[model samples]
Target: MKKNKIPYLLLMIVHLGLFVVTIIKKKDKKPLLLYYSGIGMAYVFEYVVLNIFRGYRYYPKVLKRNRLDSVFGAIVSQALIVPVSAIFITFFQLGWGWKIFFTLLYSGIEQLFIHLKVFKNRWWKTIYTLISLPFYFWLVSKWSIYLDQKPKKWIGYLTLFFTFWVNYLNINFVLVAFLKRIIFKKGWSLRKYYVNFIIAPIYGFIQSIIGVIVTLKNKKLIGLGLLHLVDQLFYRLKLIKMKKWSVYCFLPIHIVLLLVGSIFKQQMLHLMSESECSQRETKKIQSPI
Candidate 1:
């Protein structure tokens, strides 16, 4: 076995042991959905930062040149690491001191991974991990408590928004850029501009409103829409240049993400309703009937 692989293998083993203990000992089932929600959100964040944004790389590369390796790696991290960490942080009822201790310990382990060449940082930094750990723990802790009381539709909405954003960034930015450069024999040009920057955002705005009709609909699309709009605006303002083919490339990718987002939104709603029903039924059964 490669030396770098040793750390990941050991971590996976420890994570599996922790999960087994959690299943055997955990009494409260309320946090289950919250755990899943955290995992989903974390996956989206990692996809955007590491895969789309090219913030870092895993040494030896998970799955070795497979295009889907990033997705696989994200799932693995969430499955083997995120849930266990969240569960322990929530379960232990640790004080601030212990929380800090665990945060530092986690950061230290990450540093060890860096030293072992398990991860190579580009735009990523250890301090960022140190800062984010506590926030993640606190977020999961609150989520566990909140889900026990009411079903928050906003959580589902946010998840959908992030999901769409992740797909949009990766497909439009990474995949398209790579294909255009290699296969099309195209170089980044100054004269071309992206039409999806205008069209998709408008489409997303209209679809998100007509479909969801929620207050957050506008809020969700605005930032993404503006990001796209601003890209075009930069070209118009002569602040940046783009290739003409860039617009064509962006259109289909945006269309795909929009379609996927629409389908995903419906599925999320159905799942949320079903979960809510199951929780209510459990409550009734446990009530003084």
Candidate 2:
């Protein structure tokens, strides 16, 4: 049976449109940062429910493997649509009525996808989405505020986490799933993708921390050496499998990730400085002489 991709496309297009609208309408707040961070945070939530526990399934027909396809669908809805909607509501300062509207909107869309058979539920229900979305929306709204507040400590930590997370997710997917480079043993599922994806958060921010410090301290070579030694240990312990690709081969990847994490830290700090400066200027202008 031929599956309709129009629905998936339409869903993505609408959220992307919302992102654009939010960007244009809320220029001063760095909508892009908020949008992507929301996606990363929501991605974590979906990873737990959809990937780890298998709460539901999706038939987006977007990937060859059913599991991967379902994951893709989940990403579309949870990572993109949910976050985009939250940002839209926050930027516009929409009222409770609008909040209710988006909550029901997601529930309706989930039901529609289920009816179309492009999505299915194993243990999850549309009602759960209805109940959970309000909280998620509120959280994102508050989070956006936090991201702008004096560039707080958690703000930097979060920026580092998500920036490294997104990059790590991409790099790991390519290496473990597609390139056949690294594999983590004892995956909850038989699939390596699930295993690596699940364990990423565990080592993710730690690697981010390494990346930032190593680059800042100019410890790239030693840092890479230590990580490779750890991989060698994992290999010896049968905790991970490296095929055709050796621990030596991962040096470049580590280097890239290290640089990525470090660069993200630099960029985020720069943005925070700019935000603070802007706030001070606004305050000075508003104050009477």
Candidate 3:
């Protein structure tokens, strides 16, 4: 029993260490709410699907206390984004099926690269790029359709993109800076966050924006190639790491919030409509005088 416990404890420690390092290296914390919400919701759905819907015990199961970030995170790392993105698509009046399809597509491609050990092997990353060049072209097409509804106008598109980037940067910067200043007693500088914050997003956004532009232009191959190149570059530079958990953790909570907000919005609109109708009726009654 003691020996068996040792292995589990060691694994947990290693996982916790990885989690801590990942958190520390990350410059943003703003994504926390998004991340937690999405992943949490994913688990709830996965749970229902496996237990209630399918009538099967969740497979590939590990003991709860044995998990590093907690068993919940493990569940979330794989599933949270599904329902969350589904809700978002519903809110945006897009096809929920497409949204789910794209999310799964994105996750599959991302995981394939990670599991293939491409990141550690730069040559593999390059070779894989050349090999999958055509597929990614089709992949970005899906992304374009999925994201098209996000930005109504060019300005809105830019704004929405900028907002996402800012939010990502803010998550890392504020958390890191807070720790550095409060715990380390180090002075804060605006430039640190500004330059650092902009770098990753600029790289990622530019690459993705190009993919989107190319998809729009019907130059899918060229766009995907460029996107792949950017992905490789980021990986080679170690600028990006495949998030260990499923993006689901970030989605559910936010989806519920967005849905709740929309519900309130509908209520407000209905109330306003009623008020206007009452005013018109009142005017109609008094007009004879």
Candidate 4:
């Protein structure tokens, strides 16, 4: 409960409050998937602008001296708050007018944060946020609609990828950022946390992506072996510190990521099939002579 954290804490409360309300209102629909998707999508966007390009800085004061503190702040804004807001709008199907209002709302909050000194405006412009968020929210709305309907295969792929990305990022964050279980310093800039938290998760999912392709080709063993080899490569390069972690622990998790991805992909596809059946039933009823 540091004084500086109040801003982020308050924002988290407000955003999460809205999220809970949406959950209670639409609990049967299992809106959690869309929420996870929003976070995953935001992570990619944040990775590019915040981690890779250093577009901004955050000072949440949670980690205090470490760069992870700034990233924690970014996580609060990008991963938690923004995604929940996106879900709120999407679930409610807020109109274009509401979308414009939210665009302004987030833009205002950005400047307000800059003024409050919790956020740093580096290479990022509020104007960019102003321009990007409408499209972002619109895209998320389409994500919800796609999953609601007879979703296309590629949409299912992207949704599952993003969903799996959220899971992998959170678990890896707990192990690396919070618990300090292992370190990934091999090819990154001096063993930076971003290397593992951001880049490594993408590396992990690429394995899963390949797993999907290989499974389709009936080469599941090749996929599993590739996972093993990648894990070993990370360990052999001394990229990972084995004091509190090891390949024994990590390899299975990598395999599990692929499994979870595969399972969810099937679930979404089944949802599409169910939607198709429902639509056909309605059409049949309406076509009576």
List per-prediction Cα lDDT, in the order shown: 0.55, 0.74, 0.37, 0.76
Clashing pairs in 1: 192-242, 192-243, 192-244
lDDT tens digits, residues 1-289, model 2?
3565778888899888998888887887767667667777887888789868989887877667675566667767766788889999998989788999989987988888888987788898888888888988888888877776667877767656676566665566556544567766563457766666566555555565666556656687888877677657656766667677776776777878777666666666677888789889899999957
Q: Quote model 3's TM-score.
A: 0.23
Model 4 RMSD vs true structure: 2.8
| Clash number for each model | 3, 0, 25, 0
Candidate 4 has what TM-score? Answer: 0.87
Q: Higher lDDT: candidate 3 or 4? A: 4
Error of 3 at 54 (Å): 39
Task: Tell me which residue pairs clash in candidate 2.
Answer: none
Worst 10 residues of 3 by lDDT: 178-187
* Residue-wise C-alpha lDDT for candidate 1, range 140-209, written one tens digit per residue: 7776554444557676665555455434433433442344321111134431223323233333334333
Model 2 residue 271 lDDT score: 74
- Residue ranges of candidate 2 with Cα displaced over 4 Å: 20-28, 176-181, 187-194, 212-227, 278-289
Kindly list the per-residue Cα lDDT of model 3 for residues 74-142, writing each as its tens digit. 233323323234333333445535655655564464355355432122223334434342343333333
User: lDDT score, residue 199, model 4?
Assistant: 60
How high is the lDDT of residue 5 in model 3?
34
Judged by whole-model lDDT over C-alpha atoms, candidate 3 comes out at 0.37
- Which candidate do you rate higher for TM-score, 3 or 4? 4
Candidate 2 to truth, TM: 0.81
